[model samples]
Target: MSTLRPGRRFRTALRLAGIAAAFAAPPLAAGAVHFSRIAPLTGYAPAPAFDAPDIDVPFDPGKRTAVVVMSNTGTELTDFLAPYEVLAATGAFNVLAVAPEARITPLGAGLDIVPHLSFAGYDARIGADPDVLVVPFINDWRGAANRPVVAWIKAHAGPGTTLLTICGGAVTLAETGLLDGRRATTYWDFFAWVPRAYPAVQWVQGQRFVDDGNIVSSAGIANGIPATLHVVEKILGKAVALETARKVGYAPVAQLADPRFTLGMSPLPAVLLANAFRFDKTEMGVVLHDGVGEIDLAAVLDTYPRSGTTLTRLVADTRRVVRSRHGLFLVPRWDFASAPRLDRVVVPGARGALDDAPLAAWARDRHGVGVTYLRGDLGAPLAADRFPFDLTLADLARGESAAVARWSARGLEYTPEDPAVLAGAGWPIGIVVWPMALGLLGVALGTLGVRAVRTRA
Candidate 1:
């Protein structure tokens, strides 16, 4: 197979990485993948060994343990701080920042933090028996030199104690063979390296976080806070977890399975940039067009930034077209030629109610055929009077929609409304979409002509 070329997906990721680099220094770690959104669970099977224990940890108000964080170059400081602050607020655990050497760590934005402990001159007695060991992300400090840190974790964590690592930090833990034969997750990038180095470990490609008994692994740096929150909830309770989220700007929907809170990398900047365009998500596909008027094919082709364009871009760049399983879609420009012909039609009434006159006309006058009108607005009656045709309008009674009725009438039926099915097919409707396209096209052209005349005169 061919190796590769500079592709759209590649450029977008590079641009996003560039923006992140401007905020913080480039990561010194070899290779770590930032995570996207987590995929849905496909299968469910119970594992007795993976079940949570019924017994609780003995409450000791003063018996809190600190998570030793080592700040290195390109280390995500917020990844460390978010969890540190949340853990502290719980009034259950304290955090002590440490470094490889006995010196101050220069965080991003000139915020200098002194290392509480140093590996060169290490002493665990200063801090309590850290019931939980958390390895904050380190962009550098890899290879044999990390043996001491790995040894310390193996020695310190007791049978009852738990060990946790976030993002690239998990790579360090994996080096210790503690993750062997265990299900784990890291920011998506390090996936290649983790499995290559630790063959025994089971790498979950799309999970936000996976709990293997006392060991917990999380996706990327973005999920560090939530992963720590999971630990807080496990050690403390749901009440404390919810309270911590409220204290921060985080939502309290941190159920162990919810990856939205933690699995993906920060999509704020990218989403913000994309939101500048009028994003219209339709049943057919997603449409990005000029909000001021109907879809301008030229503008769509010219206006979009190549680095930040979507997964699917239409030929006319201004509008992106997508289709669902049921043949529903969204397109910036109404291109009947690019759309599918529909035998069934439904028009909506004013005030967003359903209207059936158009369907009646299409069925009766144009062809001696029947059309099932599903409920939706068809805009103004552009040719409702002239193209008056005959059609039958049937109100879909409870559990009596055409889809079901068709299935009942015939053993098998056709569904034009399945998003997944439509999306997969990438079917275009060129012949039957003339009405929708021509009306919108005329409006667009007229508006442009008016603007041009005003500009010249």
Candidate 2:
């Protein structure tokens, strides 16, 4: 008998591995998947009436101080930005995005933010506890890296400060033990894990937010919008909160959430896995500039990359950091003069109309890339619901595939009411089917080639 050549053996192994990978990808993407034995508990809990304590330390008397904490490791994009932007829009508070350090804090999905002040810097600058402290989901909440952040939160949990946690941020706050025995809510997906991890806190569901006096916790992602608006209503008054909601184009805050947010077996895992294995990815550039709306920016930065078919890079005229409308500092990944070739460019909503003529001219003239405005202009809301996530889904539906948009929404734990958003589009069966088909073909061809060689031998 003759031995198979090294090259032939390697090729055969490669073909077999490819076939195995096609079958293995989805489960790998799902990541130690487990199903809940019982349906998630759901119900609404009203915000209790409680008087906010006056600030004990000295602060600017002219405006109330609000600090949105950032974790240098990784923070959720919408979780951090929505509350910061909404609160800043009220103009009742001097909002600041403070972090554990002054480094570039990377947000989940993609995008880097520079915190306005370090924890010590905040101490020196304000020298007082904040009137409102917003905590977004930190990627390393339980790890040692998060210890300093937890410590800072504990130090700042003053009698006057109202602690607000967005999404899994409840877990981060729970780490500080302040949420012990408090009625709190978090992202619906965490229904299984959060309670098991921290049984001390009373976790509530079916509510957009639960306001247990000083500690307020909200449901996942976009739910932060209504929860922040609720905080506004509590502090600033209903009229002011209503105006803020109107400006953002979001509806009035509803006490009861649609209780349908529980998790189960979804096509999302498979869709995401297929997209992840895709070779061709669109290189997209998001224009960054001074006074850009955080909500609009977050919507674009956070949403597009989730499709798993796009990679986003921040583009600006200069590489220098630009201050967002609400005062959060964002670092640009590329300057127009030196940016690489891009497939497309996105302009997020801003406080006012940005003169994008130069950027547009550069993108078109240099790389033949077209620019799409997330919001037509500052006057119009990004979407009917005014949710950044919705704007992203709409953009994906129009620019990519409606199927991709729906799949992205499912992954993000959102359900759209309007069927038309995903209408006329079906799953990209090609992503999975074609790969598996090709792998099987390769395997059969390899087997035939091996059998022919053996016969000759």
Candidate 3:
């Protein structure tokens, strides 16, 4: 199980594309339109059955999930622990804490969590099959020259068992050849090295997570929780994942990157003006510019906390860790006013100074509009009167908000009781995007060719 080469990466991507096409359509005449209207402006038409009867998977609570923990540092501990706590709370499956050995492994800061089983001690005795395996990314990701974990995965992980990794763990996955030909993602920091180090892994940069059948790779660190919750949503149901998050007080920032940060300091109106002129698409990318800070997000989940030591490091240093390891992009929440660039912006709050003279003039000049006000605590209110295409992190979290339901591009169908509800019902769209998607591969390759020819000429 060595890493895949570039040629294999291309072929594997095609195979995955075929699977996606199969999942997207139903068996029917080539040009049948069942669910939605289609004008068929393009003469060439290929529309199988897109909306098939929903498939419901039966839930078996007795199933067990094995989580691999790192003894190195605490960076990955929170990502591991948060999801572990949230998932274990469900009692749907037993979670085993494993490390290199059965000794006490030091996690974030001075906190040491003892491993239940050592990798060596881990016998197939736990069960003939593993429901899922979680790998944490803690150390210098790219510098990982030797990958013992990958060898272990090749030996242990099977088709029925899901191999999941977060952030740096994706690097290890690359070595195992599991993700070699699949679309996957890690922390934003590793985006550059993915193609260079293991070009076989089709990297989708902006995606929060990639689900290639049994393999699930999430963005980074904390994002692993949401990605795992997505699994719970798929397996048990949406309502269950929502309850788990609510139980943990974890409000999912469903969008990839907060849009506010991306909009920069430009007046909201100016930002919206630019976005209005941008071309339309089958799926629009939602970016939350100003993501949340660690403490702020932790505070939302801090129900019965103990030491300030872990909390302090998580908020202050973790921010730096994310930046150093990744970049400014890791901030859990960001200020939209500080975005570096803004083609167009959607101003949610109209009452703010963003409505002032300078901001007003900027919006007027750009022709941006005040769409609707989004509340951070409650969630985005769906205005039967008006619904904007751009929804914020806060907007998507409202579990029962009618504005969210009615205005939902694809209305929220999952109830609070269902365990399979998508993360704010946005994952299907997110998965389709698959992080730096190559849907436009031909255009990209052609552009690169033109540039090469021009340079040589």
Candidate 4:
């Protein structure tokens, strides 16, 4: 196997890291993976092709832990990023994304991630032995026989390096045969499948995390936060882990517990900070396109993030780039040809909304497609057209009587923030999403109701 060359993904990560180095940041006790929103591509023209400027900068090297996050084309966005952010926040680890090759690795949420080093380049650049190896199961976990990831894990797990897998990540690690006799747990949704898939491993459920000696495995998406925090505590210490938790507004758990049963109502502002607690969520897709128009994605996605809902970006262009009209450059994590299973897909409108046959067809074919228009005065036709969008973000954020009724009249089965779909904290406490049957009754009764949970208690 060869290492990463000074190719596109390599140079992009290096250049982005260069820009992050310029910011004023406090030095850590050891090497750390610093993060920042990458600067908009330089000298970017209306054309797709562009050149990167030569830059001279390196990552900080004072952090104690060397954390390597492995990603391929379809790793869960929350699985990789949540751990990266949590570990990096502690200023205790030099976290990096490593791949079999240095290329644009597509991850969920319509975002592309650049691997800092290839597995073959690890010893030369980072080191032969890292403090920790973090693995998370991605969308395309099956079918690849004895992939490089398995080979790498087989070569690396031992004394001086803690090996960990998050959610479905354990499944990938199991294929390596290290967990054959070891006890483990995975996302509860796959409780039955994993045991059947990897019969040698002792697969348990209900535990947020399971630690059998050197290997630590987490239950599901948000569940990794606590398990990773525990690893932080082991290496860095209780104070640092606690501080990291506090600073991030997360309360750390010391033991394994299912997130589904621990659902807590939260405030409106804090909704953005909490993770969906479900352990059985099906992944969803948020499509990104060229010159994509804004639908306040962050604003509209307020209810989905920090939750168990696994939302990933799916793009279908050869250039493999999706830029918002507002100038935010978004790299798609999955192109259409390789896009994985998405229970739902949300498409924000662009000027060509009416003309994109593929986009319309894709959404129409999929279950629970969502559409929201950021550009106002799109005329009633655009608003009324059933191009797969049943309601606006406004109807989701604040349900209006008429709009809700209109949707009820259509008998559309999809409902935003449906607990059955995803129990995202975005829905307030005490709220009930009227089912289609009840909606029909509501239309006949000429009366309506509202219920959304509020306050944490």
Q: Each prediction's Cα lDDT score? A: 0.42, 0.72, 0.43, 0.52
Instruction: Give the best candidate by TM-score.
Output: 2
Candidate 4 local lDDT, 1-457, one digit each (tens): 5476669778879756644432212221011221111111111112222222222214466765554556554566446666666676777676766777655564534455456667876656766567788987755555573287777777877588888898888998888898999988887558767778899999977666788878888876656767888778778888888887665435434342332322222232222111212222335566666555332333223223322223434455433545444333346545655676666565545445444566657655654454434333212233433211223323332422232222221211122222221221244331222122333454433322212222221
Query: Counting only residues 3 or more apart in sequence or on different chains, how many pairs clash (N, Cα, C under 3 Å) in candidate 1?
Result: 40
lDDT for each residue of candidate 2 in 1-457, tens digit (9 for 90 to 100): 6498989999989877866765555434332231110101000111112222221233356999999998877788889988998898988898888888776667754467767788998998887899999999887688887899999999998999999999889999999999999999998779888889999999998777888999888888777888888888888888898889877766534432333245334556445544544445577788888888888887776666766667776778977767777666777757888777888887786324477678778889988976777676321334533555666777676655676776667655555545554443455565666556555665666667768999999
Worst 10-residue lDDT window, candidate 4: 35-44
Residue 444, model 2: lDDT of 68
Off by over 4 Å in 3: 1-61, 71-75, 140-147, 253-457
Question: Which 10-residue window in model 1 sums to the lowest lDDT?
Answer: 38-47
Query: Candidate 1, which segments miss by more than 4 Å at Cα?
Result: 1-61, 71-74, 108-111, 119-124, 252-257, 260-457
Q: What's the candidate order when arranged by decreasing TM-score?
A: 2, 4, 3, 1
Q: Tell me the spans in candidate 2 whose CA falls farther than 4 Å from its real position.
A: 1-60, 255-265, 350-352, 377-387, 415-417, 449-457
Q: Kindly list the per-residue Cα lDDT of model 1 for residues 46-141, writing each as its tens digit.
A: 111211222222234475765555643424444455556567667766455545643434332212233446654335334344667777556543
**Candidate 2: residue pairs that collide:** none
